[model samples]
Target: MFIQSFLLLLAISFLSAGRVPRPEERIIGGQNIEIEQAPWQVSLQVNGEHICGGSIYSNDIIITAAHCLYEKERRLEAKDFLIRVGSSLWNSKGTLVKVAAIRSHENYNSTNFTKDIAVMRLSEPLNFTDKVKNIPLAERNPAPGTVAMVSGWGATSIYPKHSYPVHLQGVDVPILTVDQFSISAGSNGQTACYRDSGGPLVVAQQLVGVVSSGYKYCDGPTQFISVSDERSWLLNAIASIKL
Candidate 1:
């Protein structure tokens, strides 16, 4: 009996060491997060309205999807953009920074979400606070089936009526192979929807992908612009900026 109990304890220890709880799963079905869990998250706004989500790449730079700029009918101007950092509450909490400039991936495809990435220079550096921080870009892609978390203030429902969550929402999802991601979205019905664009797809708390595009009405396979694929361009863009 003593030997059997020791072996059971050892097995439990190994399992605990192998599995780290993802706080995003604390809510049932990944519902509204209670704390400012993802400090790097930012809300991209146009005229005081939340348009999409973004990631705080640096004190003065934010990363998001390029397609977000074209969502409006009018041609985008720098003055039209604003970045809200350091807050999880989408209503009215966070430092608002005016956009200094916008740079989109040169190869960004307007038709599809291919190479759909962008960097926005803040007019002034953000005041890093407890609620505001920067997340590191992923150095390498994890093997397929790695679980990742996507957080945003996007509308929760697609069918009945679209509406944004009162607070930021976090959902845990498995990283499907590129092909499988596409097939799953097309076949099954897991996807990111409106207002989720430009949000970060994080693995183990590291930025790995940018919400690019997906099936319409928020029900389909969503495509993420792989950060690993755009690292070169992102580095160049950051270096070229005067700030």
Candidate 2:
């Protein structure tokens, strides 16, 4: 009985922290980046609250994680969503826009979080400028050992009580693998907590990954949904949506 109780407690301890950590989990071990460096970054919000991160694809489209669209297994409507772009802060300084539509992969599985990518159309096109630009999607995944960066407004601390930096943060992660339709990074201790789900993983100015999952603790491997793996679906989803 004592052993059973101890094991349960241990599991709970491991499950705590990070907005998304674990199969569902988020970022840490990152530093503030110049806001101008992330013109394509966005904060995915739910009913006026910042919940996840995303990347701009064009004047009207954004890419994020499929898991960010649900609450208690109920998918949210377009009316319940908005995005903040062109700012380093998730709460303030970015232009806010309404979400017009969202399309996740048909085979997306909540249980294992497979095919965790989603594309969204904005109610209106963004007025592009130096502060707001689109990120190009990668046609191929980077090889293992390449350093990529991920950005988001997520926890900076690994503790149960998370420290969320007001400004955007980024961390350099070394790729561990890009196999079976996913990209995995971190665990050598020099990674940024993936930050909020749906943020961009960039390499050479191309969007190679979408923040997907990680362990509850920050000092473990982080998984991302490979943009290259879903390129066909992404292009189709983008083309089908009308602004």
Candidate 3:
């Protein structure tokens, strides 16, 4: 299972990079932002338990990682998941979007991470407000070397096991060229890890990547499933569904 998991990580690590900076050291001096701008950002819950994170694309449609929906032999059922949107804190009451349907990419083989994407349809339209709104879909492919932003209520550091952030923690990372990401990522290095699955990788305020897998420590080289890389299939899937 470990080797299978490693290969799965490697397949997604097709891109390469050089020695990357740690999350804290790469901070931008910008003011702390609220989760409203990226209203689609959400905390995924299974049986009222926080399992991972995700992003909302439409009133009912959400995009997340395939692996997040599958844990060991326990694949999640629609009824078992709930999406909490617009709050930086977990316990805060926010719009509860019950997943009505889940669609994993047809090519998504659990042993590989090449197509690690999934969509969740909500039972009803989320009430858009200052605290909740949808994230804009990618308008075009982001250029390589573009810096993107990722936020989650995960750990603040890679080590020293600490409590999860009360407010969402944000990080800015440059998009690694395909060659750079693939090489530097290796079998293990720096990448998104536990609790970050299905999170959004935002570029210019648009959804560009989905959090898939990362290194064990939760810091180093982060690996994200590129949204632009699977544009055609995503478009077709979105079009086929009724908002």
In candidate 2, where is summed lDDT lowest over 10 consecutive residues? 1-10
User: lDDT per residue, candidate 3, 150-230, as tens digits?
Assistant: 766654543334335556556666666543112112123223445667778888778878776655444455667777677
Per-prediction TM-score, please? 0.81, 0.87, 0.78
Q: What residue pairs clash in candidate 2, if any at all? A: 20-25, 21-25, 21-26, 27-193, 27-195, 28-193
Cα displacement (angstroms), candidate 1, residue 174, comes to: 0.4
Q: What tens-digit string does per-residue lDDT give for candidate 2 at 1-243? A: 001121232234434454343332235666788668878999888766677889999999999988778755478888888899989888898699999999888898765668988999999999998779999999999999999988888666644555567788888888999887799987634444424678889999999998877655555666789999899999999998762
Could you give the candidate ranking by lDDT, starting with the highest?
Answer: 2, 1, 3
TM-score rank order: 2, 1, 3
- lDDT winner between 2 and 3, please give it: 2
How accurate locally is residue 13 in candidate 1, as Cα lDDT from 0 to 100? 28
Best by lDDT: 2
Most TM-score-accurate candidate: 2
For model 3, what is the alpha-carbon lDDT of residue 13? Answer: 54
